[model samples]
Target chain A: MTGAPQDPADAEACPVAPTLWLRLEADGTYRVGLTTTAARRAGAIVHYRGPVAGRAYAAREPAASLESEKWVEHLALPLPGTVVEVNPLPTADPGLLNRDPEGAGWLCRVLAGPTDGRAAPPSVPTGAPE
Target chain B: MSLEPSDEARPGRLPSWRLLDLGRCAPARAQAFVEAVAVSVGEGRVPNTLVLAQPSAPYLSLGFHQSFHEELDPGFLERRRIPVLRRVEGGGTTYLDPDQWFFQLAYRDEGGGRGGPEDLKRFLRGPVAAARSLGLSAELRAPSDLVVGGRKVSGNAGGDWEGAHLVVGGFLLGADVRAMADALRLPHPALRPLLRGLVAREVTSWEEAVGVRPPWERFRQALASAIATEGRFEARTGAPTPAEEARFLEETLPRHSDPAWRELPPAPRRAGSLVRRLRIAGPHGLLVFRGSGEHLAAIVDGDRLVEAYRVGDGPTDALEELGEDGDGRAAVAELVASTPSFA
Candidate 1:
């Protein structure tokens, strides 16, 4: 549903994926952004590499790469999809993923399909925060 | 030109010495090769000495416990079109291209000889002697690096699994120095220049540096000679054995390419969350409590609250999501609390 697009001015004031950011675009595609906790758990986001456009990726295929200050990580997709477009600039500079994860740092755009119930969001029950 | 008996060199004979040539194949095959070897050695069906050559591919490898996000700029890597690969062994990061020749040596040894001169001497002898047999005059430097004329041409690392050892190394055979330096997250400011110097001082490839197209057979012979292995070396040329196949899938596959493993634990041990979904009987019977960012988000202990702490975003959601099972919640909360911005 198209609610009034959150104002850029308002978005700047709002916290970004404080717990975790999950987005379901108008086309029924879901995008999940890491909470700062997730990012921190992943170390520093040093690099963000995404799939090429027009390529179909299986669920849990590496969706992106993250190189934090301490290590290098591959971010796997939870669902299958065709890579529609990648965040162009972030591939040239990975710090954006670490610094602005939900904004300019968002890694890839996938036209995702259901995973036949094989994969669910990691088992984090609602109301229980760790 | 056939060599006379007097001109022939004596080959080193090491019982476990085995060499594998993976004729042009995908990167996954290389991974599978190592896993197969690991399984064979683990089961006592094979000796420890195994050498595997990874075919050319656009791949980057990271050490065990290294985080992808922490060490590299994913954007830069993507722009250059390099795929990141995680290997079974532990070490720092490395880059592998078609021009590069990758070699892994699997030995069966526990940590008894680890960090000892004998282990280092044994590990370096194969590659070092191989290089010399090819007439390159290479030598082993301190630690594990191999230096040829003062330049480093190879880097090595290994770990033991169930009394079986796996040591793998990479030889820069006509590798792109600028590309490798660019790809890895280096620890020292001087790494690039130092690596360039090391490459110059240590390694000589068949195509460019050696002035001769050293065929793959030459590499194999050199390796065999160094290790004193006299057995008839043949290419594996087939799929892994069933037992090997199963063990590789079980022990190496999941962690090989998984991002969760690539991104290691973020917090110090104490700061790590102790997530628990199921009931636990500590001071009281089956105490249930929800926590957030190191504080108790909510508590319900057998219909009464014995203790409670502040419920932040972390503890509140973790408790609810982890309902009944009581898994890794506490660790997550403590980790979240220690983060810089959370305070």
Candidate 2:
């Protein structure tokens, strides 16, 4: 019955995007994931294959593949960057992507340059509400 | 990019899409052909395509994400000499035979404008209209299901394959409910009849819906023509390229046939000897529960009881208890309460 925490820190911690949830960490790496809305829309995720950690990708390129009961989608990286780490939890139990998309359900962490100076943002938009 | 009609286009004319009519082939070949088209289309070598095919023999097909061990009884499949393969698109386990007509559409993913969800809705509309044109009151359900009078007639799944967006679905002309029930790994032996009844109640076929079984040729042409008219596509019949066929024989079939691809990792070990694991169709979704002596793990997904706990020490004893009052849910709840709640 209670509302989710409205703290700015928590809000800034995980910003919502059209297709994914983005979290800007202090270490400068961005933790990216398929938003809970997107996850549920795709149905229960039953399998996942993520890009290898340390692999660099161009913006809009596929970084991970997710499969649910009724659909399969490839999540593209929003920015050009090298993947620092990929979450192991969803690989073993893909349902975690639906259960806790912003927490244990994160897909990967990428090290990218600052976004403020960029002329165009990533192909997918960011900053929507979760 | 500005939107404009091509110079080659005449007034009220739309682009033509190729249709591959791969009539009755081995189940593995059918799966392989779809994959080949996805690859070819994604590479921009082939035009946006609609593939129509059916399996010459019966086989079990698993969703891209499903674990074979969890969804199927391998011994039954083996005894029946039914080959099993995983598809690139997502959906639950299904039995495919010559009776069902498979349709797969693959097109280029034009970024922006329409997203995956919207595209699925648009893609399914043509087929739904086609079914309705046959005098069946079919409707499109969310996420891509075609239902008639509240029972499912067609099930669909879609995904992106490299640069192509693909949706694969099928219309059931007829089905073997008993074979389907036997193939799946139900929790208890006594549940087979229940599973058969459940499947019959939940699913429908062309014969069941229309009270007459239309010829395969007639149904195929009707669906193809209807889709062509609805989508503004000119259907051109074709076949897979020789290269695609070679790839299917060499790469696709062998990889899917691997044993490791079908197995699931071992379950987490817990205290007490494992007694039974039951998968029941609950009111909500699939109920799957496993019990090891006194420990039980129960999980419910949607209307089906996907997971459940063990009611008694053995399968026979559990079936007896389930039959006691003819109430499975109460027995499940009692077992659930007796076991420690992990949540």
Query: Whose DockQ is greatest here?
Result: 2
Q: Which CAPRI tier for candidate 1?
A: incorrect
- Candidate 1 residue spans exceeding 4 A from truth: A1-130, B1-17, B109-118, B185-208, B229-240, B249-251, B266-343
- After the best TM-score superposition of candidate 2, give how far the Cα of residue B262 lies from its true spot, in angstroms: 4.0
Worst 10 residues of 2 chain B by lDDT: B278-287
Stretches off by above 4 angstroms in model 2 are A1-63, A75-84, A91-104, A109-130, B1-12, B111-115, B264-286, B291-311, B318-343
Cα displacement (angstroms), candidate 2, residue B196, comes to 2.3
Residue-by-residue lDDT tens digits, candidate 1, B1-343: 1112342234542233344555555665564467567556645565444555655576777654445665565655778776676554444566667665656555444211332223544666777877777766667764456765555566665543322445667566675655555564433232234334433333344445465545667776567555443222222223345666666566456555565555543221122332321111111111112344333322233334332333334322222233432445454344334422200
Query: What's the lDDT for residue B30 in model 1?
Result: 62
Model 2, B163-268: lDDT tens per residue? 5678888887786767766788865564455556656666788878898766668767877887777666767777777766776776667766766544423222
True-contact fraction per candidate equals: 0.00, 0.39
